[model samples]
Target: MLILSLGRAGDMNRNMLMALVAIAPLCGCQTSNQADYMQIGYGPSFDVAHAQCEMQKGSVDQGYIAIGSPGFVAGAGIGNALGNLAAEDQYMKNCLILSGWKRAPHGQGAAAASAVAAGTPPTPYGIQRAPGSWINTALLDWSDANNKCVAGDKAACGTRAKLGARLRAAGVNPAPV
Candidate 1:
């Protein structure tokens, strides 16, 4: 039984050796060719530039920058690669600075906070609405009514007055006169 066990172990070792030999070449397989790696390294600057532009466009665009995945991935990969490259590090640093990735005293977050403190409402352009606070029907209707009144529609003004009256009747205000 010991002799049989020894023989089986030897056969298993041989099979493992053969499997390793078979997989050696495959292990060295280049998923990304030289050209592909180069393309990945330096494919297009436009997308990056566009991303930067969108970020600098304002709070709306900044919100987009905060949430956008493709741009973040591309930027991070490129930044890491360039950061490793001694020759292009300076240029990449400048690019990153220009793209607002670098720290700044009066950057977007600070500016936004200041604006909020100043009682200014942030505009949602490219920014996504939060799930729970999405689409305030009352505010939308109020805005629509205001827009119609601004367009000189007497009916909208009357409708707005009626809404005000209803709110006043509900003990909400000093009663719409």
Candidate 2:
């Protein structure tokens, strides 16, 4: 009887050990995918790259650049550390966008409108006024117009009035003022 009891206890112990082994992963003891990415330093880089890409694509606003600047820097740092020029470029582009570097048409409209309103004087097609000024104006105008439209003011007539003084000041031609 004693031997039989000991044998039963041993079996029970083995079963318990097996059960623990099975449940170990489910008991909050395993690393999550995000955690794994963090461990490999991929999460931060990916996030920065993603943001930079979006900004370059003009899907994100310039104001958000400040927020994503650090991410871009970190991403670039990581890419450089890993000796990946492609990744570094991707991150650097994002940083530039965030730093108010205008790329293309995404921010053009706002600039035109702002130039018109600020009266900063319009640049004849080939003329230039400061490095990123045009792009900035286009972006600002686009964002303002978009916001007004979304708020049920698609006409943008009101904004035109408000920005008129600035436009006149800037010596923008064909001014209403």
Candidate 3:
């Protein structure tokens, strides 16, 4: 049974390697910092991390990056290290987006709308209507908090919980209705 399991594990690893290689080109072209490309501009007045914590109302969960790239001999693990960072960066961006962060307009583009601003309309249970400014601040704050949380900071988790409580009482940003 042990031998059989080892064989399966090796097969799985081979498959993963193949997939990673296949995706490498796309990853290279796209770079990992999707959020940085977004050009969001938050104001000085808003408490970005706190607000994001309130609006998101959830915990941050991110994936781990593998160390040591197979391709390198001189600095074998550098590629893998970078890959891990990219993965984490993407994770942070996605986390913030889920928490209602909007991507700002880039040059030709106009200011991007968040889920609420877009009016896609979410479930009625915890809906809120806060000012766009506040929401924007929260969006940034949430991202920072999420980054800290993913980095294994326990205090950030507590902060998020506190923010959630405050929002529950006062209402949420994006126009706390």
lDDT of each: 0.40, 0.41, 0.42
Once fitted onto the true fold, the runs of candidate 1 whose alpha carbons sit more than 4 angstroms away are 1-79, 82-135, 169-177
Residue-level lDDT of model 2, residues 1-177, one tens digit each, is 011122345654664465456545544532212111111111233345445554454323122111133334333333333343344445555553444332334445355445545854234231333345654464345445555655788477566555544555666532221
How are the candidates ranked when ordered by TM-score, highest leading? 3, 1, 2
Compared with the true structure, what per-residue lDDT tens digits does model 3 show for residues 1-177? 011122345655665576567656655553322222232332221136325543443233333333333332212233444565466556556654544443333531122223334753222112233346555445445545666776899998676566655554556632211
Q: Write down the TM-score for model 2.
A: 0.22
The deviation in Å at residue 153 for candidate 2 is 2.2
lDDT for each residue of candidate 1 in 1-177, tens digit (9 for 90 to 100): 011122345654664465456546644442311111111111233246435543443322111122223334334433433333433334443444453233223334455345435875333221322223323333334455666877899998876676656555655442222
Off by over 4 Å in 2: 1-81, 84-139, 146-155, 174-177
Q: Where is the poorest 10-residue window by lDDT in model 3?
A: 37-46
* TM-scores, all models, native as reference: 0.23, 0.22, 0.26
Task: Give lDDT: candidate 1, residue 124.
Answer: 27
